[model samples]
Target: MHETKMKPTINITRLQSTFDVSSSIGTTEKGGLTRLALTKEDVKIRDVFVEWLEEAGLAVKIDDLGNIYGRREGKKKEAGAVMIGSHLDTLPKGGRFDGILGVLSSLEVIRTLNDLNIETDRPIEIVNFTNEEGERFTPPMQGSGVITGNYDKEIIYKLKDKDGISFEQSLIDSGYLGDIKNRSSNVDYFIETHIEQGPFLEENQKDIGIVQGVKGTKRHRVQIKGKSSHSAFPNSHRKEALLAASEIVLTIDEVAKQFEDLSTSIGVFDVTPSVESITTEFVEFTFDARHIDNAIKDQAIRLIKEKINEVSIKRKVEIDFEETWDANGTYFSKEIMKSIEEAVESNGYSHQYITAPALHDAKFMTDITKTAMIFCPSKDGLSHCEEEYTSIEDIEKVTNVLLRTVISLANQN
Candidate 1:
């Protein structure tokens, strides 16, 4: 009988230093980063990641959507690589650890391979997906979405930032346009190390989270149209879009309360006839709903639509629902989930299998290949803000788990 061999372990200090280096790319006064997509911060951070990749002695490449890949060779050259990483882009005034942790942790993995001189049967690739924050762009996970054929290059070429700069222009500006390969199919398994971005682990007294599933999301641009009127003439005879919008917002809140696992919020809205003296003729608002179960998510969205119609009827307004983006729920493979569980146990760290309420690039990659995620706890359950954080000790714990899992996956046939 053949015996299973062990792989080399990663260095904790090196991983911590990698985290420091990336965090330094777009450092803000508030102890966070502001590396919005396609901005100068993005270029600076991409260059930093590329430099580290080269320093680790790995061959680095950039994809069409500006996704970065750093590869370390293995014993079997033809075998598919084991890819692990997250995004490098950050939201406006975002935390330091959210997406950066996964990228830096993967870098640490490659650095460990270089230090130990240990080669596996399959290569390992560290990926830094572009514009995962969706802050500058419309939908988040733009790079992964395009790579997985969710959207076409023409659409990518059309996407522009607030400054009216096209995404294609940004790609060219960043010097990333090249004949990049479709490395998605080349990956046999994918792993992401991330901060939990929630309080589940901390509340449960755990150090890490073995992600069981990621929530599917539906984003809607709901428009409530009503006749504009004078502010002093507050009567049923006069139609007001603001009132209709207020009622619809309340209805959305009510719809959210109907489910245990469902979540709903309005992130952005715009009103026409913008003045204190007059009522608005049109009101446009956004609806963001997420759920682990498809059935519940669908029902919740349906109920929101029903309420929107109700408000429109009561206020004599016209309502229209425009879908911005609706992505299906995603699940990680059992083998990879088990690897995370075992890694946590082997390291004596307490963990739990939790559902990710926030969406990620991993959700999009599920269509291309098997995906799994590891999470460290966020302090105060904060994310997408400058206050979002995970302690360095906690970061190291999750990176160690990621290292073990990646080494094991790289050795698989």
Candidate 2:
């Protein structure tokens, strides 16, 4: 059994105040946030966060990837720091709670430590990873990915946004470009507290989700080429690419239901001559499949392809299915997970274990160090929209859990 005592609560009012102020930066008319990574609004928030960190007597550092780390020294300055945080960048029209709350709650942990005059054996650091939403950046989690050495920094620097602004140029302009040597790669533990972004916890009537892992994601582009004819053409004589595409779409959806805890979605769809009179001669769409188990995910991929091939042959059309991106499923440290569970128990919050369907910075952090996540409930299983919400009480519960967990880990030799 662990031998640490815990009794600290977060100042909910203060956290709410900070969250409200941040909600205004890059806020949309629909009450959502659009603070893409390294934008002016993002810069404003970073400045505010740094100011708060300095006031709390923490040393702040920014890396070449624009990832921010604020360190509160411990009695043992040489010990690896316990890092806790999430991304702050928001998707276009994204709800304010998704990434913003995790970051602020982490800062709250540090503030509470100061308020109580508590000192630990290990240092504590709060991080704010950049470009987690990939709204402006083509791929999300670039900061975490680059730091983990999963992506080359040169390629990441060369990526251009829709406006032709290179990522490297944007970072330089944001005034956050820092030496790569400062990448706080010496973390002993990394923890993140985020809204569930789905209805799992709320639907189950649980207060906290001790996240076990993140689902692996795979993306594929399916391009279908077929003969084009007028809409009035005989149904028997036509080879419509749209028809084959529709069959594949239905096949994916139908197969998803056959497997438990699997999700398949089509986000992009393009067609040639999409008019009333002309038949679709060309069609392309992107498919995303996510599951925690690689074996099951691969099985699903195989089944989906088999069905797609059946459609291609039956429809007498050519189909090209090519994978564009993939991230393997990642599991958190069992030891860190146990630590979170202990915090949940001490806080007397109802909880359950879950696997996140969406990728997070924590997923990539696991590549470098032991990492875990705490999840508060999202209303109606909705996210990436202005309507996403989690109660202040829920935030309080998780932040308190984070505080207690940090204390325990920091006290460890």
Candidate 3:
């Protein structure tokens, strides 16, 4: 059984004040934050966060990937520190709570500790990683991907945004360039507080989610090619690409249904022909499939391939598939998982264990440390848009949980 000890109550007022400042940092249309990764808005927000970190009386370090780590040294300088934070970068017209809540809540922890003159046995670090949204860059979790050694630094630098601004150029322009360093053992335990980004918590009226694991994501680009035929020739001999594309779309649903535990989505689709009567010569679509278990994810991928091949052969259309992304699911350590549950129960916040359908940096951090996440409810299940909303009261509750978890880890070690 874990020992029962309580620290001073974290200053909810100050925490809410910080979150409000962050809520307006990169406000976009419809009260959304539009700070994409490595853009001007992203730079402005990162700079503002640096100022907050400095004011909290912590030493800050920026890595080559522009991930910022702020340190509050305790009496034991060499002890492995406890770290907490999330990304500050926002998606295009993203809601304010998606990434900012994790970051600002971490700041609130530092602010509380500094104000109370409470010194733990271990140092505490607040991290604000660059480009967690990966909207400007490609593939979300760019910074954390590099930190966890899942992605190479060179590949990340070469990533380009819509305007063709390279990730390297963005880092240099933002003055975030720093020496590349390995991210390991700087912390013994890591925690991040973020909005649920889904409707599960709010629909259930739960105040928090003790994340069990991040879902594994499989992304594919599928292409279907058939003979362009005359409008009048709509027979089976025509091998119309659009016809085959429709079949493939339906197959996605069929295959997804076969895997009851997984979530599948086909978000992007394009057909070349513009004329209504003309059969499209080429059709392409992207598929994003996710599951918390690798076995189920693998089974889903296999079934999709089998169905695509079968349909292509029957329709006599040329078909091709390429895997654009494969991110594995990540599980949090038992100790950290227990701590999150304890925090939830101690604070009297209704909580449940849920898998995150979206990818997060926490997935990468799991490779290096004992990592977990705390989730607050997203109002109306809105995220990645300007409509994203999470109440300040919920943010405060998660912050209190984050504070208790971090302290519990620090004191135990």
Candidate 4:
């Protein structure tokens, strides 16, 4: 067993102050935030992080992708570092503690270690990954995706927002376009602390959640084309794209219900020339599906495709399905997971092994290193909105667990 000379303590007051500082940058009317990646608000938060890190005497570095790293050197410089972090960007009007909590909690862990003057064999790093929300970008997890070789830097740089501004331009505008290499292949382990974003923990009365894995997600765009006609015309032989789209949506819901532990939804449904007098000529909708099992997820996709085809043929409308994004389910490292469990047990916190239904940067980090996550309860299971919240008491509990786990990993051989 790795021995500790002194037990570290997390400063809840300091943590709250840090949250106040970051949340102030993108305050919304509804008390949420809108700090999109690479935006001015995001840059302000990054600058604050750099200041805090430097004040703690940790060496700070920013990569080309604008990933901020605060490193605490160890006795063994050759040993791989234990990387811990989450993204800082939030969805539009997003809650203050979704991804931001993870990053700030990791900083708290580092701060606690510093206060104790604790040194481990392996270096410890707190990373603030850029664009984990991907609200502006098409796909999320861009920062970790780049580091894991899932995305090319050139392509990511060219990605444009709704405003037609390129990602490169935004980074440059924010003054965070660093020259440091974006890739880190030598990460010994990775851990992220985040809000549960669901009601499971709160409902179960657990203080901590040791996340076992993340569910896979598949996003697709479905377009239906049909002839336009006057609404007053006879409806018997008319091809209506909107009608076909409605049928497809119902079919998707039915198919999702057929499988256990599956989620499917059509978040966006658009009809062209949306006038009450004209029959719909074209319709487009986005399909999002997720499942913990790959086989189940694939089966659901197949069923949806078959249903769409059937609907198209019956409605006499041409349909096209375009796959927009896909990410397979990821399981965390067994060793790291065990360490977290141990930390929870040692800290006398009630915890349960859980799976993350929403996508996270830790899913991508698994590609390059052993990764795991710690989750605290969110009130009412609300996230990505202004109502999302987790009590400060819960935050403090999880932060302690995270600190213990980090200490354990840093001292490991």
How would you encode candidate 4's per-residue C-alpha lDDT over 163-217 as one tens digit per residue?
9999889888988887756445568999999999889999999999999999899
Candidate scoring better on TM-score of 2 and 4: 2
Candidate no. 2 TM-score:
0.98
**How many clashes does each candidate structure show, in the order listed?**
0, 1, 0, 0
Question: Which 10 consecutive positions of candidate 1 have the poorest summed lDDT?
Answer: 1-10
TM-score of each: 0.93, 0.98, 0.95, 0.95
Relative to the true structure, how large is the alpha-carbon lDDT of every model? 0.83, 0.90, 0.84, 0.89
Tens-digit lDDT string for candidate 3 (199-290): 99999999889999899999999999988878898585788788888887888788888876588888789987858777788899999889
Better of 2 and 3 by TM-score: 2
Clashes of 1: 0
| Window of ten residues with lowest summed lDDT in model 4 | 1-10
Clashing pairs in 4: none
Candidate 4 residue 150 Cα shift, in angstroms, is 0.4
Best by TM-score: 2
lDDT, ranked from best to worst: 2, 4, 3, 1
For 1-413, candidate 1 gives per-residue lDDT tens digits of 11135534577777777777777878888888999886888898888778888888888887788888888877888898888999988987788888888998888877776776667888888888888988898777888888888878788778888889999898899887644573445888888889888888988989989888898888899887789777888586878888898988988888889898788889888999898989889989898899888888999888888888788788898888998878777778889998888778877889888888888888877788888899889888999888888888898788878877877788887
Can you give the lDDT of residue 411 in candidate 4?
88
Best by lDDT: 2
User: Of the candidates numbered 2 and 4, which has the greater lDDT value?
Assistant: 2
